[model samples]
Target: KIKRMKNLPMAALDSETVTVVKRKVKTKKKKVKTERKKRKSKENTSLKGKSEPKDKKIQVLQKNENNSENVESMKIGNGHDIEEKVNEGKRSKEFESGHDFEVELPNKKQKSSFRKGNDVEKSGEVSTGTVLKKKKKKKNKNAEQNSELENIAQKKIVGIKDKMNAKIIQATLNTKYKEEKLKTALKKSWSSNGYPLKIDTCDEDSGIKLMKRLPPLYYAPIFFNFYNLIDSPSKRISMFYFIYLFQFKQTTDLKNASTPSLSALRNFLYGPFRKYLMNITGIELDNTVDMGSSLYEQTDVLLCHDDELEGRRIAYILYLVPPWDEKDGGTLDVFHTDKNGQPADIAKSFFPVWNSFAFFEVSPVSFHQVSEVLAKKKRLSINGWYHGSPVNRPPKFVELPRPVKSPCHIEQEDLYSWINHVYLDPWTQKEIKTKFQKDSQIELEQFLAEDKYEALLEAIKLKDLKWHYEGPANKRHYEVTKANKAGELVRECLKFLRSEAVFLIFSQLTGLRLHKLAPPDSEDEEEKSSEKEPSPCVSQEIRRVSHGSYTLVHDDDPVGSQYALDAMLFLGVSEKWTQALGGFTSYIARDEDEELLTVLPRSNSLSMVYRDKETLKFTKHVNTSVKDLLEEEQQFYEVNCTYYE
Candidate 1:
């Protein structure tokens, strides 16, 4: 007889726990079926031929059938514990196939077998595959949750970065009044009908109509009465002056500043502002920042330049100055280029207005400069270039052929009449030659005859002389005497400096070969004479130096571009002249910022310097103080002569 199990109630479990228990029950049922097949096969073998044992075999078969029916009943029961089925199935399989496998219990009235089996399973009898399957499911759920969290974190990071960039842009610009106006200004095509329209924010009915007829040049300026919340990056800048050579004070290395406000402003301009410009101009701009804070004190100036470096797309300035006007002399001046691409006349001048922004496209014709600052208040501004893909540049401009040199063939008495007698002495000549050879330069004080120097000084101040102004203002700005337009004494002084006698004398003094013959001190004179004689050539100019006069190192000046022996005869300089009033010539190595030498002006002194191709020279701009020190003319003269062999 088979035992009947009592139905038992159980606490509800989660779906996953219940599923694990049910799968274990199904595996036990499969094992029970295999046990029954083995028992039946053995019963069939035992009953093969013995008739006397047939009745007993039949009874054993009936008992096996009853056990199978009891197992099926256990599987069908709702409250049967899965642990009981697993343990019962194992016990049934453990018995030998020929042994009787019968349950000893009363039907429907015995201790519950499932409860006993639950106690057994609780003593650590769970299968390894069931534990591993539960662990794997939990791990998969954790992995999915971690991926979702990472995606959320990544999105937050990107959003924060974008917000920070926007904040920086808004802080640097006074967008309340300027943003919409700027957007409106950029809407129009930069150039139209062969002319560029002006972008002026001060007035609505500005020069747009008039500009249609003007030459093609792009210019924009934004003026506002209000200031931004961010401090001006240029206000606290330290300055180093170039003196009168270039004459300005500017901050060096304007990147990665320690100051918080300066760093923030730099980020704004170099990042968001650059992207805004790229969008407006439709050009690919670079990420690098090039900028500096500048301070222009009184008399400081920046001469004309196009800002046309490789990859430079646009030039910009943000004026952080006080109220200003044209009289202040620190205006941003734009120039028109002539047919030869040289800066010509000033096309427009924009005075520094407090909190104004200005910019222009950089090109071969975009010549501009900062005029000399005349006000005592400092002119403060932040200026820089926005770099982009480099545009196709025309070949470098080659200046017109230099004026032909005149042959040296004047009388010897003419030289004697002007040159100091001390310079004529052989012993004195040897001393100058020795010094010149050592330094490649010399200054001869009282270089002319006493009487001749006195006459020339007085003649230079004559009002009858016709002065021709020289410019494009980029390279030089001064006066040159018109042909036959100076006094007779002044003309004679110029002629004396260009004479052949002076050339040979200069050769003996400086030990340079200026004629067919070698210097008097040369050892192999016969050998030098046999060689091809260098053609002796000379060119001279008489320049009038006054307030604002200057000569810059430009490609157009032969002295700046080639090797030459330069002799400068200074006249009419007052005894009270000081270096502070400028008008000194400075020599520096090519492509270098360091000043190598400075030649200060003194009346009747001659400055001779042999400059190689690697050297460049410029006369500094004379300030208004020249008027107080000199006579009413407020000017002096320089007889500049260059010798070529």
Candidate 2:
């Protein structure tokens, strides 16, 4: 019976299908009729209180309502078109909910209905429910994706806004701290003192407290190994000058790292702090700034200098050292200028104090130096220059007149008494002349008589000799002892070097015309007139060199620019004197940094050189080791003389 039912033809089951359809239609009709009667009775009650509609309008409304019912009933009776009936029922529901027209469904909903309609015969009710659910799910997914994209865009905008706000705040803070924020006390002190005021940065009004809080800065060792001919123990080293045992490190711009604190500090110094400096110093400065951190350990030193450079208005040093005293030997010594622009003496000395600041206008008279670091503590600080208008410098200082000498007669017996016997030999003189001509220099060891050398070494210990301290500090620093102030033996030695007999000997040794009476081939009146112009003369000094003594090559010195023959006889030199102890004489080319010759101190030795106008010379700064000899009352002496041709 089951197989017969499954195999039944479409027409054979038509009667049963029709009966079921009729029953469902009858149930729907009853519900619809009941709802319609309620709506009609409500309408009649509402109209009872108002005028009746026109007869033509009433007839048209009734006709439309009847037609809608008839079409729904026809759709329900067709079992094969049951999907159409469901659609019409949905339309009726929309009208009941107060819609006046047939509502348009989404394309997706219409497509799903079409697909489900084709499957209705096989799956019936399940397909219809599934299509509606899928349509709703697709609509919700689209909404969710759109919402997420908007959120992402909003977040990006917020991130950009936050970055901009941070930048604005930083700019405001920088602008808030201006030149007006500086303390009045600082400006008043600067005005009163004129220069070199010691500032205590620990005070809140100092306006540089941020520098103290920054992390430790880095430093590199700044030791320049060569003995400088011009400037020594300088904070800066040039092609020719070196800083001997300087033992300090410096940054060129204080930009060693990129840490946040370091960057902030750099910005503060280059920006707001620069304005404060301009206000306090009352100097117009540009935006250019040169800043650096420095570290000075034990034995470090900075020699005397005027801090003069182009466009540098103010020089400043901020001390970040530990507890210090004058005994510690890092005191800042400010020199007083003589009537000339030369540095004369320390007008004032300031010891390094923790968190103290010092500043001065950079000018010709602003000579200063950092004393050697004696204690084991580190001397840390920040030092730099504020650049602006060029300094209106004073005229270059004219040095005191140097003594001049003409060749004078001296007996051969007087020369033999002091000079070594070997130097007097004609054969040795010929050999020296040959070598000096080839190299322009020569050093004669044991050039003095053995007995005379010993006597002069002993006589140099005499305390009665009047010693004149020689300095402008920037050009030369040493002690000069005149021949009249020296003992009998020392006086005789000084006289012999300047005598005509020694001048003739020097001419023979160096092949120079130092002792020549007339020019070579002087037969013409022009040559005779040249002789009357000026005779080749000699300048001599008995120099006593010890610690803190040096000579730099300067353009203002006329003698260094001339062609001359030089002779130096070193006496009373320590046996332990080495090149490292400094005090050596160096000769270099004027236009270049080439070293021509270097003569270290050797007791009883004579150094002679003939140089052209293109060469210059300087004495190496005697290092602190020379101070040790002072305790034993020992001194290093030189009979230094220059013979011009």
Candidate 3:
């Protein structure tokens, strides 16, 4: 049964996590004027180098071998210590079937030490302990061991066993080849759309033959592939291979391992699998293949990216998930690329199918992401890239710096009025300020006055107003209207964003000089537009949005490198708020990949976080997990504000 997010301020909906992926009809290449047609772009490599004369496939693949990824990364996992404290009294811990390579789950019965506040018990940063050394030796003995394991094979396995190869696929479904699957002259069609590509069969012969050629193909194969291959599975390898750009974690790998599964699958990948993929996609690759398994249980997610790695020709994945749905997440979510080649939004998404293979040739525009898994089942899959000759080169494109708002002007009289009306007392304020200076963040439970919060909540729910979604989802999925677009009473609440009362509250809580983001000036008001650097003082913007109606996850703030303060004002949906439904936010330590804090966007609460230059934060994705509610209570809404410091 699906776990429900119960007692949430916005009671969760029971609706299936339905994703309406907007798929456009395939557009044939159109003729264009020579001047208008942009030249075919090559790999800019973005942040990594590309296009050297030599084929670095073997070297690169060898370096990337057997990487084990922490499925939840810092998202949350099989009940880490933090999870135990957070889920205390409400949820039970679940484990990965094969092995417990993860750190110990938190003990639930401990006293709840951290809450919505600045006074958290300081926890040490996570370190993997094993030191990587540069010394090299002993390849012969390792090879001998691997050779022995390969000969002692396990019985056959296939993930999605129904469609083994073309013949079996044809026999079972009577699927006549509409076109030859692995046609020699076939060329990849992924450049136009960064959407996912799927093939039910490799066009090989039978299940027995196909099964034999593949690895163990165990259900949820992550532990078997990553942990067992390691010289020591208990000690996690401290390296990070981001699933997509959204989710990243220190991964476990077989870089120093030589296991039987790896040996058995070696010849097949280098020979048949390699040859067949090339014939079908019509993309050439040398004998090098770089691959590994990624396992994700609930709350784990892989966000968006173009997969622009060095020497990566085609990025592909073969799933070994239990029976699942898009709701189960871990889906191949493809995005639309803007003409400039940056990811735009999600165009299509496909569920993880057993024994199925999906791939796309890595390109300048090949953007895709994996949705956060919500299902109770594990999503285990092995992903790899076919490496070949490098693509052409192009100069990197640098984004122009966006100007920050000038400080908003606040009248002294109105400031005093709000101070008297809603501010925290002076003595308590001093304590918070002291804590903020030391820790860099704070949370305010019941941040707003009861009366004002009630009025703001009612105004935001005005039925006549329409809510819009920013699509092709790499951008984000919250409603289109920023909080400032709400009706009068709700807009009145945003005034707090620029109010001296909140500024003082912020100053006391974050030790940062807080200033209001100036109301945007008209273009005519600028005196010769120039990029003026943002002030060190804080500036703010408010957004009113909702995602409780369905499932979603947003980008890891694109302008992440900058320093700022982010606030979430939970509009009191009244007594329904609960943590299980997770419309919460997390602050990630930039240097350690550690999660510094998680704050629930609970009603009547204000979660304020200081974003130092080295850290990034994201609101955890959420969807309706309960049903049958009053229409007004069906969605959870947050009045979001960002203050740049």
TM-score of 3: 0.55
Q: Give the Å error, residue 340, model 1.
A: 0.6
lDDT of 3 at 28: 36
Ranking by TM-score: 1, 2, 3
TM of each candidate vs. truth: 0.68, 0.62, 0.55
> Cα lDDT for residue 439, model 1?
94
Reference-based lDDT, residue 76, model 1: 17
Summarize candidate 3's per-residue lDDT along 1-645 as a digit string, tens digits.
Answer: 111111112111112121211222233356323312432233332221112213211111111113321111111122111111111112222211111122222332232212111122213322221111111233332344333332321111121111222112111111221235413212333222222323222233212111110011111112122212212222232334322133323235433333333433444455766776666555688977876667766656665656777898877676766788876777776665565556675555667876555666676566677777777777776577889999784544344433344335567664443333334576777777677667777777766666666776777677775667644344445564554556876556667565655655575556565533322234542332234523433333333434332223223344566677777777645355454444566666664546678776667777777776677665555533423345555456676666664
109-144, model 2: which lDDT tens digit per residue?
Answer: 342222211122211344431112322322342344
Report lDDT (CA) for all predictions. Answer: 0.63, 0.59, 0.47
Q: lDDT of candidate 2 vs native?
A: 0.59
**Compared with the true structure, what per-residue lDDT tens digits does model 1 show for residues 196-293?**
42442343533221122123333343432221224545545665445334677777757865343455667778887787766655667888668788
Model 1 TM-score on a 0 to 1 scale: 0.68
| Candidate 2: regions farther than 4 A off | 1-182, 191-249, 253-262, 517-534, 591-594, 627-630
Native-referenced Cα lDDT, model 3: 0.47
Ranking by lDDT: 1, 2, 3
RMSD of each: 24.2, 26.6, 26.3
lDDT comparison, 2 vs 3, better candidate: 2
